[model samples]
Structure formats: C-alpha cells, structure tokens
Target: MRKIIASLFISLDGVVEAPDQWHFPYFNDEMGAAVDATLGRTDTLLLGRKTYDGFAGAWPEREAAGGEDAGFAKKLGDARKVVVSGQDLSFTWRNSERLEGGLVDGVAALKREPGGDIAMSGSVSVVRELLAHGLLDELHLMVHPIALCKGMRLFEEGEATMPLRLLSSTTFRTGVLHLVYALAESAGDATYDDAKVHLPQDEA
Candidate 1:
C-alpha cells in the first residue's frame, strides 16, 4: 500500500493556520518553486469538509487565471480529490469525490486504493482521526519559526497517542524547519513520553 502523507506549514506553538501572516511571503520565486516541487510528487488530495469548501472556491479560479500559482493550482484542480464530509457537498471541480461516511471509515477505504500516496493540506481533524486509528503512514511537517499566540492547531484534545520515528529533518534559510516522520509500531516498553510525540500546548 502507498503511504498516506500529510504536509502542513505549522508554527512553533503548533498553529497550522495562516502561515502567510508569519513566514509565508506572497508568491515569491522560492515559494513558487516549492509549490511546483510538492505538486510533482502526488496526484491525490484528501481534505475535510471545510478545507474542501475553501479550496474549491479558490483553486478553480486560480487555475483559470494562468497566474503565479496557476500551474500547480491546475494540477490540484485536476487531481483526484477526496473530501471527508458529514454533510452533502457538490464540488464544481472535476475529479472530486465526497466521502459521505464517517471520517475514519472513509479514510480506510481510501487507503485500500492503488495509488502513489494520498496527500493532505489543511485537514487537521481528519489527520487526528487517522492518527488515532494508526492509519497514517507519514507526516511532513514544515515547522515555521514564528509562534502565533492563537490559531487553529494541528492537534486538539481527547486524542490517543501514537509513536513516530524521525525519518529526516532539514532547515531552510527562510527559517522553515522540515521534519519528516514515519509511524512506528509501539514497543510498549518505553515510557510514554519517550515513545510518543505530543503536540505543543497551543495545539491542545
């Protein structure tokens, strides 16, 4: 089975929202190049209901404009999209499908598919559900330097713990730290703190 990967730009305090307010400079050459590089790696995008709505409203038009993010946005517009939603949702974008069941079951079905990997952007709730079930394979965290005092976080309360092994780490001159981790089978011998990774306090 292909790995399920989640990549997000997060803050020091674990906030994953509005990175542009902190580290993201708008549409610079480096940002464009990074967007292009990430798009080349995957063709499947998974999202929550809210992220689906947000992206659906933006990417299609951005693709049409033929602007800076246009090429990558067009690829995303054409990529297979799976949205985990409790409510009924119809998307204008082609190749988009809604997961009309509970998030866990929906993701399990997705994981059974034959593909390279399923990629997630702003699907924190869905990520949490997958992590709790130990269904995710990889996490690509782009840790930005600034700490937002308040924002939506990648982790919330009342979630089970799962252990991860650090696969790689890289630091960019822009002050973004990239940490890639893979899910590991729990040995059940080590102390919980030593074995499991916890989210930052603002994430709670």
Candidate 2:
C-alpha cells in the first residue's frame, strides 16, 4: 500500500496559512534539500480543490518560463495529480485528474494502489479529513520561528485530540524545525507534544 505523507509549513502560533509571507524569508539551501527529499520520495500528489487550483495556476506557467523552480514545477506538472473536489474540474494542469466521488472513499482507494507514496502539502481541509480518518501515514511539519498571531491554524478549535508518536526531529540553522510524527497506537503513551525537540534560539 502507498503511504500518504503530508508536509506543511507552519508558524509558532500553529498557524498554517500564508506561509509565503513569513515562511520564505527563513528558507535556505538546507530547507530546499529537505523539500527535495520529500518530493523525491513521492510519485503522486493529493490536493484539495483550493490547493489544486492554486498550484496549477503557479507551477505550470513557472515550468514553461524555465524559472527558478522550473525543475520542481515540471516535476509536479508531470506527476499524477489527484484532486479532491465536489464539482467537476473543467481544466486542471498537466497530468491532472479529479476524483468525482466522496473524498474519504476516493482517497482510501488511492492508498490501496501500488506506488512509492502519495504526497500532500498545504491542503489543510483535506489533511484534517485524512487525519480524522487515519488515512495519513506520515506528517512532516516544517515549523518556522516567527508567529503570525492570527491565521488559520493546522489544528483548529473543537478539533479532536489525536495523539501521535515522535518519529524524528531535525533543526536547521535558519531556525526551522522539521518534525516528523506517526499516529500513535496508544494515547496513554505517545503524544504529539512529546515530538518537540527544541534547539537554541538564534541570538542576533
């Protein structure tokens, strides 16, 4: 079975929105390499309607222009993209297709396929649903140093408490922490907070 891995850019206040505003400044070669590793591992992409529209608008043209992210842009453009949407998508980007049924059942079917892994990023709605259904196999959070104070959080109010086991933690010089977690079998033992492996704050 293919694993469903979600990688997200998040802020200190648990805000997952508009990572481009504050998240980009902290990015470096190390971060790029980390992102490369994740992208390399997954052959398929699972996106919600919003993220699908957003990325299709960006990556295809970017690849055509032979820009900075052209390689990755082309990679995404060429990869098989499965979008979770209610209405039928008229025109998606290259090699894209829409799943025209229930999100949970459709995605669950995708997981049963023979593949390396399926990658999802920045699709908070879909991520929440996947997490709730225990469909997500690996969760990678790229925690930035700054706090937005207000934004759509990764974990929202009235969200159920889902315990996770800490898998690994890697800190960059740019103060971005890469935290990996797996869904824990026993809440009495492992918790998500147990995954916080902190590093020294950069004194400037």
Candidate 3:
C-alpha cells in the first residue's frame, strides 16, 4: 500500500496557513535538503482545491520561465496531481485530475493503488480530513520557530483528539524542527500517577 504523506510548513503556534507570509526568513540548506528528501519519495501529489489552484497558476509559468526554481517547477508540473474539490473543475495543467467521489472513499481508493508514496503539501483541510479518517500514513512538519498568532492551525478547537507517535525529529540550523509522526496505535493509558516514580526527590 502506498503511503499518504502530508508535509506542511507550520509556525510555532501551530498555524499552517499562508506560510509564504512568514516561512522564508528561516529557509536554509538544511531545510531545503529535508524538503528535497520528501519530494524525492513522492510520485503523486494529492492537493486540495486552493493549493491546486495556486500551484497550477504558478508552477507552469515558472517552468516556462527557466530560472533557478524552474527545475522544481518542472518536477511539480510533471507529477500526477489529484485535486479534491466539491465543485467540478477544468484542469488545464498536464497530468491533473479531479478526485472522483467523497474525500474518504476517493483517498482510500488512491491508497490502494500500486505506486510510490503519495505526497500532499499546503493542503491543510485535506490533511486534516485524511488524518481524521485514519488515511494519513505519515505527517512531516517543518515547524518554524515563529508564532503567527492568527491563522488556521493544524488542530483547532473542538476537533477530535489525535495521538501521534514521533518517528523522527531533526533540528535545523535555522531552528526549524523537522518532525515526522505516525498515528499511534492506541492512546496509551498512562496517567500522571504513572510518572510519579520518575519525579525528582526534591520535587516529590
């Protein structure tokens, strides 16, 4: 089964919206390599409508312009993109297709297909939905050290609690934390009392 990996550039306050407004100041070679590694494993791009629209508008143009980012742009343009939207869309970008049915069913079907891992970026809603439905296999977060204070967060109030187990963590020179997580098989039964034995003698 192909894994559905969701990558996001998030702020210290858990904001995942509009990273373009606050993400670049911390960009470094370490972060670049981390992102490159994620892209290296991705064969298909699963995108929400908003993210798809942004990419479809900019990437094709960037690919044609032929600049430093053009290579990455071309790579994005070449990938098979599946856009999730309730409304019908006319995709002009090559190798783009609309998700056929409900988000859960469509995505579950995609996971069963034989291919390399499916990757998603900047699709906050899609990521939340996938994670909520147990369809997301791994979540890779590049957590910048700044707090946006006001924006959509990966987890919001009234949302169901999700327990994730850390698979790996890397701290970049820029202070951005690259965290990889997978859903926990169980929300462990440990409580505060279970940690009492480890308390410092003075504190106890």
Best by TM-score: 3
Whole-model Cα lDDT of every candidate shown, in order: 0.77, 0.87, 0.90
Candidate 3 deviant stretches above 4 angstroms: 202-204
lDDT of 1 by residue, 141-171 (tens): 8787777889988876565566789999877
Please tell me which predicted candidate would have the highest lDDT against the true structure.
Answer: 3
Name model 1 segments beyond 4 Å from true: 26-40, 186-204
lDDT of 2 by residue, 18-118 (tens): 78788888899988988877774567999988988899888889899998889988788877889989897776587789875588899889988888789
Model 1, residue 164: C-alpha shift (Å): 1.9
TM-score of each: 0.82, 0.89, 0.95
**RMSD over all Cα atoms, model 1:** 7.2
lDDT per residue, candidate 3, 77-179, as tens digits? 8889999999989989999999987899999999899998898988998898899999999999999999889999999899978989999999999899999
RMSD of each: 7.2, 6.4, 1.8
Error of 1 at 188 (Å): 5.5
